[model samples]
Target: MVTAMASLPHIDNPVKLAVKDVAISYGGRTVLESVTFDVHEHEIFGIIGPANSGKTSFLKTLNRMDIFNPSMTFTGQITFNDRDIRKWRNVYSLRKRIGVVFPLPVGLPLTVYENVALAPRLSGVTGKADLDIIVERCLERAALWDEVKDRLDSLGSLLSGGQQQRLTIARALSQEPELLMLDEFSIAVDPVTTMRIEDVLKKLKKEMTIVLVTNLVQQARRLADRMALFLDGEVVEVGITEDLFAGQVKDQRTKDYLDGRFG
Candidate 1:
């Protein structure tokens, strides 16, 4: 089981997610296999890989999103809080605890305020006062509050691309998730917005474990404490982010990918 060595304080934190010998398939055709890793609490664990390497597919499996795809099949153990995810009786309950952000923002048809409040309301957090607090707090966490506080009643779809992306993050935060998984979140946003969101992520890791699957190798280096390099549907290496950059890697491909030689 190859895995990264955790950097201080974060190493002391308990594991928030664990995946062992995991494999994925589509219509019996294997896409990824023998994957294993643990995401420690309150830390950013990055997965860097080139396209079609199964990075996004792997993240979907963690939240059990496979249930929505009839052709997708998976085998292996995935656990959260030491309980196998496959053993969970309620799929929605599992998802609520593990939020996901896609490569591109998908804004709801509802108002800005409603988008952030929808999850809590569905979870039974009703009272207007309570909803207000939850909505504001989530927006604040996503760094969208100040920009849209006055436009709360506007439709989320009406927000600019960057604002909508942040709105997506705010909606995820509304779930009050224990683990947040972002799959190429900056793909559609501008560099400025990407940096802003990255800054927000740094602060957010203090509140929840984060799994960041990005194609940008430098982005991983800047934010990840520990990370894994995935290529051709395999994890080539896992180590402290700097250690990999410093050439402390078992696979030459790992250093090559990090150095922009390929990937």
Candidate 2:
């Protein structure tokens, strides 16, 4: 059986994302507080928590998705590539560099080929040849190309739920994001498909930084070089994935959660 590296591939890599004393709120109620962590370049940084732990809310803050929700608020400092993301005047440009995949598959109503081509086209790739190359490369990266290569003309929505999820991944990769964030991407996926996507994520980390928010501790253990445990809107601990399971934790509750005694 294959196994993930016992430690980070590049432990000394510079920080790609830094969250300092961050807090997220909705309508004046804090959902996540005191979140401080640094995600290193080209590493899969996992966030694991139970429901209502503010994991999703924290992800929104990273990409500045709060702009879509007026009631949502963020405090503290978050830097991407050593630059304050809040200072960016162009949210579109920020989003282009940070791709996000939500819990559910959001396949566009367009054909499979078009769905993956849309981002490149919007980014000014007009040549059909260039688009074809991009579309194939992205789909292959997402592990969906071989299955749907012949069905590129089919509506993306017509694919199986797992296939659609992979399509969403392919679409995100088409942007060539420097940082990719996925929120519970496997919730709707089957075990087989989940494993396939996990393999894809393992390979993708070599190409980009990935922030993975998952409820499955085992999944995080398998993929993350390091991980943070979020409980009730607070980060309880952050450490190397293997070390955490080897009885390292700041709080007893974290140990319990990792042991499956509680979520």
Structural similarity to truth (TM-score) of each candidate: 0.96, 0.96
lDDT of 1 at 36: 91
- What is the C-alpha lDDT profile of model 2 across 1-263, one tens digit per residue? 01334334656898999999999889999899999999999999999999999998898888888999999999999999999989988888888999999999999999999999999998999999999999999999999999999999999999999999999999999999999999999999999999999999999998999999999999999998899999977999988888789887778888999999983
Candidate 2 — which pairs collide?
none
Q: Give lDDT for model 1.
A: 0.90
Per-residue lDDT tens digits for candidate 1, residues 46-158, read 99999999898899889899989999999999999888999999989999999999888999999999999999999999899999999999999888899999999999999
Q: Tell me the lDDT of model 1 at 193.
A: 87
For lDDT, the strongest prediction is: 2
